[model samples]
Structure formats: C-alpha cells, structure tokens
Target: MRTNTTPTRKQAPVINFACPSNQSGLTALIARLSAAVAEVEKWAPVEDRLSLEFSKTADKPKVKGGVTKAQQLISDGEPVLDLPATDWFFHTRDAIEEGRAKALAEAAAEDRAAIEQRYVALLADWDAQEAAYNSKKPRGLAHAKRMVSKAHRAWSAAEAAIVDYEPQTLAEAHELLAYAGLDGKRVFFTPGETDLKTIMRNAAAAIALHGLN
Candidate 1:
C-alpha cells in the first residue's frame, strides 16, 4: 500500500523552536556552559594532573622540610611559609573557577551577535519575497494566495515563531485572508466561466482555485 509520491515542502529548523533562533534558549545555554567546562579541562593538563595526585585523606600532605607542594611549586623552589600548599590549592582553584565564569560570559555575548545577524537577514529576505510577489502583477486572487505565505514569514520573524497557515478548504482560506488583511470578495474566474457563468460562479471559483481571496 505504498505510494510513489514525494512531499514538496520543508519547514526551516528554526521554525520548530520558540526562541529567537535555533541557537538561543535554556538548552543552548546549558550546552554552551558544558562546552566551556570541556574546553577548560581539555587545556588544563597541569591542573588535572595536580588534582588527581593531591586531593585526599586526613591532613594536608607535606613535602620535604615540613612544607606542602603547592608553596614550593608556586615559588618554583624554596617553600613560601606564608602561602602553604593548602592555601595555595584553594587560591588556584578559585582562579580556575573565575576563568570558567569568564568563558561563559564571552560565549553568551557571541550567541547574541549571531542571533542579531540571523534576525536581520531573515527580515531582509522576507522583504525581498514581498517585493517579488508584488512585481508579478497577479490577479486579485493570485495576490491574496501568494501574500498569505509571504505575510506569515514576515510575522514569524517579528514574533520569533511559526505563523504559517495552510488552508485546506475555501472557508479556511478566507479566514487566513481576513487575518492577513486581504478581502476575499474581489476574486473571481474559474474553469468554464468564460460566459454568463463567470458572473455567478463565486463559490465555484472558491472551490476551484487554491481557495484564496
């Protein structure tokens, strides 16, 4: 019972989301923060090695001469008594946490920049579509039908949501037209309406056409 037909329409991925774009939302925020953590870990080999070896049991582990390793490493030689390994470890950990905060801030700013570019480009493209459709000088019916789709794209960008309407019947089409500021009474012309039938075939034209205007 399979049919050899292919659908001819596709919705943009951004249309599926309610945010400003596919890349801005709570999900994207978490993703960016998670990526920052991975980036930090990927590059902090020295810190990773130190954490694995140190962080453990009872009292602070002391190196030669009653001094901890953190003090010796920070000074590169003699122990810094005032800055013991315990204190130095906490200081270094806090600095790393600060770096993670900065990374997230920078990433959020980048997403804002990219989202602005996407919105600007979307509005420009829709403006061009409206112009192209208007340039065709279509009949009243054709104009209404084409503008329904074109107007929805403009509204979608403004509201950051899909507002498309695909009518399956004449009543539905008229509803869409009304919502889009189009009057449906002016459209006419259907097949075999060349003579007197043309003057009295409003409903025929409605059902015959793609149900617009």
Candidate 2:
C-alpha cells in the first residue's frame, strides 16, 4: 500500500468584489452587503454536505494494515496478499475538510443574517416615517410649508437610522450617512426656518444691504 501524508494546503485569497467609486454612498453600501450575503448562501450547501459526511464517517474504526477482516480472510486462500486499501487516509482528510468547511460556513451565515436584518429594519423605519409625514394635512400655505419642513426633518432622522450597524458594516454605513447629510450636521430644513431657495436668496440680498448700511 502507498500512503500520501502531505498536509492540506491553505486556501488563497480571492477578490470577489470591489466597491465602485461612481456609486452613491447608499448604493455602494447596499452592493457590498448584497455580495456578502450571496457568498454565504453559495457556500452554505457545500458546508452542510461536508459536515454530514464527516459525522457519518469520522468515528468509524480504521483497520490495521489497511485491510478489513473479511479481506484478510479472503487473502489467506490466495497465492499472494491483495493490495492494501487506502480508505484510512481518505477518511482522515475528509474529516479535517468537513470541520473546516462547517466552521467557515457558519461564520459567514451569521454575518449575512445580521446585515439582512439591519438593512430590512432600516427600510421599514424609513417607510413608516415617510408615511407619517404624508398623512398630515395643512390648513394654509404657511402651515403647509411648515409641514413640509417638519417632514424633511423626519426624513433626515429616518435616513440616519438606515446607517446604524455593527463595526463590520460601519465603513460603508458611515459613508452613506455622510452623503445623506446626517453626520452631525443639521442639513434638513427645521420648523420656522426658511429653506425655499428663492426666499433664502432674497434673504441673502437683504442681509448684504443691511451690512452695507
């Protein structure tokens, strides 16, 4: 019998994805999250099969000299001994591979689930806030403007919630929040603030005139 005792080789790094520069902050984050989830889903099935194979075969006893008792009995009546079997080596390798695959698959699955939960919750919260804004009615033009301003504020806050996640997802999330003007700046129009472009432009002119005087 011939036995090969070489150690298992380590897997090489593969670059499966890279965020594009032209994508909006939110788009980039979403793309990355989607890729991560897809990878986990792709490998989960292989991991399951490997784990099952290991469980069914790892504990079975290995025969000495690579021969089962029945094979040894059959060999006794023959002129020469039959070739030794190599099941032991193959079984050992399978056991090791199964363990590795199971661990990697489980870890990836956890990360995928976390990102999905956070992403869904963020979308739901945004929809709920927008719906609340839409349901309000205004009695006059001035009130209507105020309502719009309030809604903008609510929308900004809702968008902020979309970027909340664990450290693993923070790099993309922070970029998205910064793009949405939620990174500690009061970007959205507040109640009583004049945010209409025409109004603001006229106000700027009035301020200049007053300064000259």
Report the Cα RMSD per candidate: 27.4, 27.5
**Residue pairs clashing, model 2:** none
Q: Please provide, for model 2 over 1-213, each residue's C-alpha lDDT reduced to its tens digit, 9 standing for 90 to 100.
A: 001211122212222445577864446544554443444444455455554654454343221212333343255557755555443322333444453455456667657666555445444544554455444422243443444444333333322222232122344434443443333442331212222233234334544554445
Candidate 1 structure quality by residue, lDDT tens digits, 25-108: 323322333343343334355444433443331133221112354533335676654644532221233344453455456667
Give the best candidate by lDDT: 2
Assess every candidate by TM-score: 0.17, 0.23
Clashes of each: 0, 0
lDDT of model 1 at residue 45?
53
What is candidate 2's TM-score against the reference? 0.23
Judged by lDDT against the true structure, how good is candidate 2?
Answer: 0.39
